[model samples]
Target: MRTLITIVAFLSFGLLSEIQAQEKHEILSPQEFCDKMKSDDVQIIDVRTPKEYKNGHIKNSTLINFFDDDFKEQLSKLPEDKKILVYCRSGNRSGKASEILENLGYKNIYDLKGGMLLWEKAKTDCY
Candidate 1:
C-alpha cells in the first residue's frame, strides 16, 4: 500500500540520520568553539602536555594532560551530564581524546578543529 511504503521510507530516513548523528563528533572552528564555550556550564578542557598548558590556555578550561599515565582516570572524573569541549595544540590529540571520551560514555564532546594553532590564527581572544 502507498501508506505502508511512505511509513517505511520515513522510518528508514530517521534511522539513518540517528546513526549519522551518533557517530559524529562536533568539530568546531576556533571562533565557533570559543562561542560555544561562552556557556558557563560547559566543560572546557585542554588536553595537552603540562608544559604546553603552562605556556598558555583557555580562560576557564581544565588541564587534563592526554599523555599522562592516568589519563583515562582523569577523564573519567568529569560528569557526563555536561558538554565537554576539548582542544590540543594542533587537533590530533584532541581527536583521539574525543573518541576515548565517547567510549567512556560521554554523550557530548566538541573538539576544536585545528586546535590552538587555528585559534591563534583566527586572532580570537585567549587567556
Candidate 2:
C-alpha cells in the first residue's frame, strides 16, 4: 500500500509539473515586443508594483501590478479587444501575469523575454 501511494504521488507530481510547463507564457524578445507595440490598438502593461512603476517604465504603458491586492479589479479595466504586451522588472512576475491574462480570456497576450531588465539592456527608451 505504501509503495502504491508513493507511485501515485510521483505520477501526480510529474503530471502537475508537465501541465505547468505547458501552461507557461511564451517569452518574446525585446525587439519582437517592440515591433508588436508599434501596431495600433496594442496595450502595453507594466506588471511591476507601483513603486517599481514610479521608478521607471515603458513609455505610454499602463500600470496593473500583478501583486497588487486589487490586481484582478485593475486588470478588469484593460480593454479585452486589444493585444496586451506585459512586462516586469525581471520577467518572472510578467510571465505569471501573462498566464493569468490568458486564463482571463485574453487572446493576444505577450511576455517580455527578459522583462524590463532585457529591455534596459537593449537600451530601449522608457518613460
Candidate 3:
C-alpha cells in the first residue's frame, strides 16, 4: 500500500510538471504573431512537411518538418538565441512543436493561434 501511494504521488507530480511547462509557452493570436514577425528579428519556423511547405507558407519561414525523425537534429542549426515564431497548417502540430522547444529550454517561443490557415484567412495585409 505504501509503494502504491508513492507511485501515484510520483506520477501526479510528473504530470503536473509537464502541464506547467506547456503553460509557460502559451499560443498567440495570428495578428499578434504577425506583428512580431514584422517588427522583431524573429525566426519564423514552419513545422510542416517539406511537401506541404513547398505548396505555400508564410514568407521567410524556415521549413522544419516536425514529422521527420531528425527534426531536433535539424533544429540544432537554428540559433538558440533568436526569438522563434512557429506555425503549422493548423494549430495542432505547431503547438506540440512549441512545447518541445520549451522543454529543450529554448526561450522566446511563440505559436500561431490558428496556424497558417487562419493567418491566410485573416488576410490582414501581412506576409
TM-score list, all predictions: 0.81, 0.75, 0.78
Kindly give the number of clashing pairs for every candidate: 0, 0, 0
- For model 3 the local lDDT of residue 41 reads 65
Query: Over the stretch 1-127, how does candidate 1's per-residue lDDT look in tens digits?
Result: 9999999999999999998878646899988898888886689999999899999888888999988999999999998788899999999999999988988988779999999888878966543
Model 2, stretches more than 4 Å misplaced? 1-25, 123-127
Indicate the residue-level lDDT of 14 in model 2. 99
Worst 10 residues of 3 by lDDT: 19-28
Determine which window of 10 residues in candidate 1 has minimal summed lDDT: 118-127
> How do these models rank on lDDT, best leading?
1, 3, 2
Top candidate, metric TM-score: 1
lDDT of 2 by residue, 1-127 (tens): 9999999999999999998766635678998888888889899999898899998888889998787888877776789888889999998988878878777767678899988888988854332
Clashing pairs in 2: none
Tell me, by lDDT, which candidate is best: 1
Error of 2 at 88 (Å): 0.1
Q: Is candidate 1 or candidate 3 better by lDDT?
A: 1
Per-candidate local distance difference test? 0.89, 0.83, 0.85
- Per-prediction CA RMSD (Å): 3.6, 4.8, 4.7
Model 2 score (lDDT): 0.83
Instruction: Report the CA-based lDDT of candidate 1 relative to the real structure.
Output: 0.89
Q: What clash count does candidate 1 reach?
A: 0
Q: Which of the predicted structures, 2 or 3, would earn the higher TM-score when compared with the native?
A: 3
